[model samples]
Target: MAFKEFNCPSCGALLKLEYRFTETVICPFCQQSSHWTGENFEAKGEKVILADYGSKFSVGLQASFWGTKLGERKEYKFKVLGRVRFEYNDGFWDEWLLRVEGYEQNEYWLQEDEGEFFLFKKFDNLPSVNEYSELEVGMYVDWEDYKMFISEKAKAQISGGEGELPFRVIPGEQCDFVDGILLKEAIPVSIEYLPDNKKAFYVTIFNLDINDFVFTEKKQENVY
Candidate 1:
């Protein structure tokens, strides 16, 4: 295990954190949220409580799952970080910030809605705002030679967050997106349009089956 220390640029508070691909943190002194830019931090905004606090899956829960990536067998230990609530139409969905381990990448997102659990990641190589702004719902895009379409094109907001994150997640950070769906698997594919093109994008998405996955609770251990 290794550790890293730095000063909060916002309040000059000594920011000591667990060093293992940490991208964002909230200062214990000023309570200001920041993004770790490799070596430095830029203040994003103040953090706020998410719109919905009670859910089946809360932040800081630990779970293990037999997930497949790149067509290989690997283990995944996920720690829930932040939970952002978005108001869409008369319904809503909670976006859980997950700090992932055992995977090649450091982090990803897990979302649970209705009776389905979704796994998603951000990918920036897609058609940009200007490129896809004119795109309408039900439009198809060639992806992996599989037919993908814009399913729900709407706006959302970062209702709140907890723990560390990699994006400027000031509560109420407006979000707009055009979601893609895979018809065969009824998969809610990845497609998030970051407001400032700052947060990461989504490229890969999967519908995790409970039978093929395992989950466990987090231990009462201090990561620090």
Candidate 2:
């Protein structure tokens, strides 16, 4: 995909497309939401400009790390393309969209909350459930022959976002979520329940070491 630039419809502030799959963009200049239609930005509602809380990650930042998958470790590089903040009872967490180099699936999510980090990749085969009301903490789910136990069930509201995101972020939208842990492998599982009964599943890495990542100021070449 080629890199593209366009002006924000709300304020005419210049913005560039950081990833190929962007569906929503938050203008840094005007702090408003815009929908991307492959060619142009359509102005939408206003979005909050998240205050700097001294986070180590930011949109457009690049890093390389030794990431582990299925007990195999390999070096990988990725860029921070966007972020969405979710507010729950405990406070909030930032979910970052990353474009990882050399991965079969280029996009992944890195979640940070209260100084703890987790890396997650989109997972198919959502658990059998009609709604969030059916799930409770400690409920057992038999998924792919693995016995998983629900660890958390909560509702979180979308607070704000930055840069380019794969999905549209509607501020103040409520999201119901169920989190489980695969007992045998000790892997985490997450399911986000959206409006219209749409759901998203993710395979998570719990407590990923912060030291494994190395951030850089320079942009990676050939990202396009």
Candidate 3:
């Protein structure tokens, strides 16, 4: 990916956008968030979720994982692109947009709630989500070897978003998503199904340190 020289319209601070799959960016210096309007960057609003619902890993954080089923790469470094907060009736969760190194053609979303994690990769050829959108709990769905159980399902709205995102994800966009879990193994895995046309996705669990990816010394705000 290439870096594009630009300044945050909200703050006077100089910012650079990696011309990867992104449409919005937040200034690390001022916490000013803006949306990319294709031609120009327009100020959206100031990011507010930095304090409440803090994250272990901050946006702009860099990390690498080996043998990713999402990208089908053996090993690749990924940059934390953006963090979007979703609020349902029960509670809220955080979803992170990640950009693969050297590859801007695709983007991935890593959803995290508490210690539970789910990495979603969209596949067009996969079965339509509508076919099993109403899967009841206690029922199992086969995915290769593991039989994943429908854990929970609900609708959420994008409460807040900061940093660079894959597309225009402004506040107030409602999202319909579903979740599943596989308890067959000692370490249970999870799944998140989206109602998007070609947006069916699955997860691969991971646990990593925030210190390794975030520049905490320079940033005081929390972005999960």
Top model number, lDDT: 2
Estimate, for each residue in 38-157, the C-alpha lDDT of model 2 and write its tens digit: 667787766699876667788878787787777888888888888988889988888898888876265588987555677888764365543578788988877677788999999998
Residue 105 miss distance in model 1 (angstroms)? 1.9
Residue-level error in angstroms, candidate 2, position 159: 0.3
> Candidate 3: which stretches are off by over 4 Å?
29-32, 45-47, 52-54, 65-76, 102-105, 124-127, 131-148, 182-200, 205-224
Q: Cα lDDT for residue 94, model 2?
A: 86
Candidate 1 per-residue lDDT, tens place, 1-224, comes to 22677777888888665435566676655657778776677887764445443454666676766667679866677767656566666566787767667553645777776656677875545444223475579887666656777776777766555555655566667777677776575566655655576434454455566554554553344424
Which model, 2 or 3, shows the larger TM-score? Answer: 2
In angstroms, the error of model 2 at 219 is 13
- TM of each candidate vs. truth: 0.71, 0.87, 0.65
Higher-ranked by lDDT: 1 or 3? 1
lDDT of 3 by residue, 73-162 (tens): 455577777787777898887878777677557556777656655555544335534344657667777766666777766766667777
Worst 10 residues of 2 by lDDT: 215-224
Stretches of model 1 off by over 4 angstroms after superposition: 6-23, 27-31, 37-39, 68-75, 127-132, 183-186, 198-205, 209-215, 218-224
What is each predicted model's overall lDDT from 0 to 1?
A: 0.63, 0.79, 0.62
TM-score of 2: 0.87
